[model samples]
Target: MANYVFGVDIGGTTVKIGLFTTQGEMVEKWEITTRTDEGGKYILSDIAASVEDKLAEKRIEKSDVAGVGMGVPGPVKADGTVIKCVNLGWGIFNVEEELSKLLALPVKAGNDANMAALGEMWQGGGKGHKDIVMVTLGTGVGGGIILDGKMLAGTNGAGGEIGHICVNDDETEVCGCGNKGCLEQYTSATGIVRMAKIILNTTDKPSKLRQIQYISAKEIFDAAKEGDELAATLVENHGKVLGKALAQIACVVDPEIFVIGGGVSRAGDILIDTTAKYFAQYAFHACRQTKFALATLGNDAGMYGGACSILNQ
Candidate 1:
């Protein structure tokens, strides 16, 4: 086996890279700005140059490296073909081949969310479990499903696109994905604020939320924890939608546990308890025993997961 591995998580604004031992111990991590100009033609080359520089600075030989693993912010086929990553201005192309040729080493790639799930399963919240679902509740809801320690990439590389699942048919507003009433519409960080605004406008609940010029998910959760009835109710409603959706997902994947991550998940016990309570109510009886935990890897999860991908292969 090779001595070290590199993990790369490609984002719209930056690319996070981590150097790790083959045994999964992260040695160092860093980031570089994402140059998305010219249809992202320079992104991969830039990453390759960065990795090369790191190798030289560390005095690590290319032969001693196992391979590089990458997480891209879009659907990626098992063969490393990125369907499209609009965030990076990338079109359909085989990413692994390009990067591998650039570095003259083996490489692997997967969806960013899926990589996060792998990272959790490897050393974070989903540790010791082979079946797991990771939910990231940020500006948008993102998810990744892993079963028996394998990612379900699906035929179109959209297997774990849980956020796009239609949850409400009556929604009149469109989501970023051009869908209405998606699970993301009610469960993401933005979704929390959006719902709070609706409640404050439609009803005179006299919420602390009304005082903030710019309400955020953090403030809402803080108010709920501090005994604000309106905030608590909003949190309950948000949890209800999220729990119900997770229950439906459980019926399909039957994962061992759900790992919650992202900015909104910082609400901690309030988020987990409320969601778990409703999950038990809606989950299939056999699946009600599934567990929920917060992701421990945080922003570094994608990096760990990217490395884990190559190591696993």
Candidate 2:
């Protein structure tokens, strides 16, 4: 009678939890504050307590639960060892084993980005595709690669750290990852704003972007939609770097589709269309036809993906 499963997506601010049937339907979902106090010592215990309370409220016995699958904002090895999670104040440890012991159920864990990709593949934008790559463009860039229905977690669980891929060796500034000219430096929300500032500083062209003291990626895209030449140029520049990076990834993983998510993806077709153009321009001829779409699940992707992981197991 193990008909239900639990999915947990842990973030710096909150932990999203979902109850799902074995058939992949999310029955209920809730969130809890991610208390990072005392080196995050209480996080696991809090989650266990929440699960117990939820089960009791639903009048569902533990024997009716399948398992728990979790997504953490860090690299996770196949054996469920978390390399580290600075935001959670966690060091290298076996997250799956520890949580499993607390909840007294089987547990599976993966990088949050990878879990999002799996979620998209299961029921979101990447549905019906076994090979897909998901790119999330928020404050920073993160990616997940799913090939033939399997997450390619590299030896160090950094297989899909596509943001850190060196895109410009000639650049002098350092990225957040301490790498020079990483893709995230050129494609993320902050990156686009940085590019807009560079364009404003280097060019004499009249632009609406010049009027705004604080620019955002959305503002730039909005200006582009309004036919602002400078904003369009910035978008094109972002497209070039993003497309180039994705093309490189395609040559290796050759995913059937690319699903773009995160806050910046709110630009919708403008972002997808521009990036797809660049991807086609730089892509190997064999990959020129690769599909691209926007992620539909938004924040819930991680929750759905966590449940999918347990169901698949």
Candidate 3:
């Protein structure tokens, strides 16, 4: 039986790869620049070459390795068909079949967000949980849903796109997804900054943020942590918007926990506590007891999740 597994997380800038024991322990992790030129034609071949190099360096034989699992930054069907990945300059194609052919081994592929969720469920903050919702609050919000330890990648692979959930029908501004009032517009890093501008413009309240020409989620959260009243209000609104959205999600998935991650999540306990407080207020009584946590695996989560996915196959 194969005793090793490989996890690959392909992103716009880099491809993170991991060699792991079948049991999920990371043997080593590394990354390679993503050559997205020419429709990303060289991406797969590049990954295959890197993997081969790693195997040779470690003196590991192909027979000792299990199939490879990968995470893509686009919607992917259960059959491994990538609908599209504009970042990678890729279009619809059977990613698994192509990659598998290159390595002469089986391969599995999934949405990058879902892969992070699986990694959390496998060994991160959601380690002990069976059902989980992971939200990544970066420049934009990304979401992943895991049920009974399996990824809930919907038919079109658009599942767990919590950021796009329409939370504010009144929003006149269009979201990056070409929609209005998406949850991401209020809960993501850019969303927070957007709200800050709106709030500052309408209110005469004094805020340190008003003095800073360029404000980021970090500055806002830091000010809130220092007891800045206006910043606090921003956080409160963020919590309310995110919490209410997650409550709606619970009515559908009833996940046991919500794991928060991404750059904005570096705000740590303040972010979790506030979001949880609001979650309890809006969540149904049955799901009000759902737990909350911060994802501990960080960027390595996708690699770990990729390995977890290999086991499923």
lDDT of 1 by residue, 128-214 (tens): 999999999999999999888878888878978999999999999999999899999999999989999999999988878899999
- In the range 51-163, model 3's lDDT, one tens digit per residue, is 99999999989999988889999998889999999999999999999999999978999999999999999989899898999999998999999998888889998998999
Which lDDT values do the candidates have, in the order given? 0.95, 0.93, 0.94
- TM-score of each candidate structure, all chains considered together: 0.99, 0.98, 0.98
Q: By the lDDT metric, which is better: model 1 or model 3?
A: 1
Best by lDDT: 1
Q: Which is superior by TM-score, 1 or 2?
A: 1
The sequence of per-residue lDDT tens digits that candidate 2 reaches over residues 1-313 is 5899998999999999999998888999999999999988889889999999999999998899989989999999988999989999999999999999999988999999999999999989999999999999999999999888878789998878999999999989999888798999989999999888887998899999989989999999999999999899999889989999999999999999999999999999989999999999999999999999999999999998898888776
Pairs in steric clash, model 3: none
lDDT leaderboard ranking: 1, 3, 2
Off by over 4 Å in 3: none
Candidate 2 lands at a TM-score of 0.98
The segments of candidate 2 whose C-alpha lies over 4 angstroms from its true place after superposition are: none
